[model samples]
Target: MCRTTLTLGLTGLALLHAGPAATWLPVVRRRLPGLAGAGDADHVALTFDDGPDPRSTPRFLAELDRLGCRATFFVVGETLARHPDLGRRTVAEGHEVAVHGWRHRNALLTRPGRVTGEIARAADLVAAVTGAEPVWYRPPYGVLSAETLTAARRRGLRPVLWTTWGRDWTRSADPDSVLATLAPGLRGGATVLLHDCDHTSAPGAWRSALGALPGLVARCRELGLRVGPLAEHGVS
Candidate 1:
């Protein structure tokens, strides 16, 4: 019995010295923001940002309609104010509208007062158009800071980051590449980041990424993944 205890103690020490198996903890958390209804099944959430663009948004909405899916739109304060009709349509279509900052400024670099103004102004705009304050905020470029988190929390908005990004902001990111990048995390409970306004890309180049949506949805379904609103997963 003494020998057995010694061996067992040595084994415990060895395990401690070996450190954690990196693979055991996935590089990315399976779900972020800890939404309410997340489950093991393959489920995905779609979101669009930097939008309320008159031309692109309508097209994007039509595409979602074709797939019989709803998405969340992270609207810029300035843009939403410029195109209130587009914002209204997003709500009318049963999509959730969230704030994406006022000027699309990088929240990480912004001052606390500026951050507060940015988020609050955007929330006000979203609430005016949608009849409710936004519950989610996605910092421009997925950049987050202590100030950003604090400001967001104060406004009752949860900071949501994407689990996978398609790099749709790049003009050269064709539909195939976007689909490929997201293929791995397409399983479920994924928050995918795509852009409706790609100023960096060729003029109107986001069309290609938009073109890929239907097929992407089909592929996810084939893999037994269900696509739905983030709120359905208790994200809001």
Candidate 2:
């Protein structure tokens, strides 16, 4: 290939890998609400990622029960495979189970074929373990490549990113900080992202999210927003 042609090809390839990640931007979320998991104006979608952990996921399940709320748990396939019972329990408890990829690796860094296989594997494990067909896919780190989108489509999983996140993965995070970080985006139609386990986070970081759950649900109810899983969020 000529120098100019090769340059153009490289640029196009780069865009293909990173372009869709623009959805993570606020302007993109405003423009493509469905992609951002924005749903009914009177409801907020609650989602958790990197879970099915026996060490901490059970606690989240208990807390959700106490709050009388249902949230979506996006499980890593490898992790869920080890704790299939936990996956089943999440669904049995009235929560939704979705795919968070086979592992917590970013698609941007994975080869297309590997990303494709991992997504499919994760989706299959979710269905097999929970007996519920997963409906959504959230790439690790909220980064999406062209391959990630294609894999999700092929598996019939709608790609969703959060409208707001608790930043609770940090060791420094606390209930107050998680709530405050999410305060601005705590609105009707927002998809709230949190972690039920700390597999890919600081040890015990999940506690921050756990601590914030009651207050988070309360604040949403205070604003007249129904808090529930994405399945009930009415996302397009």
Top-TM-score structure, candidate number: 2
Clashes of each: 2, 0
lDDT of 1 at 229: 62
Measured by TM-score, how close is model 2 to the native structure? 0.90
lDDT of 2 by residue, 33-111 (tens): 7877889999999999999899899999999999999999999999998899999999999999999999887666676
List residue ranges in candidate 2 displaced over 4 A: 1-23
- The superposed Cα distance between candidate 2 and the true structure at residue 23, in angstroms, equals 9.1
Q: Candidate 2: give its CA RMSD in angstroms.
A: 5.3
Q: Write the per-residue lDDT of candidate 1 for residues 135-233, one digit (tens) a residue.
A: 888766555556666778788987776666666656577888888877876767677767776643467767866977987899878878777766664
**Candidate 2, residue 155: lDDT:** 97
- CA lDDT of every candidate: 0.70, 0.85
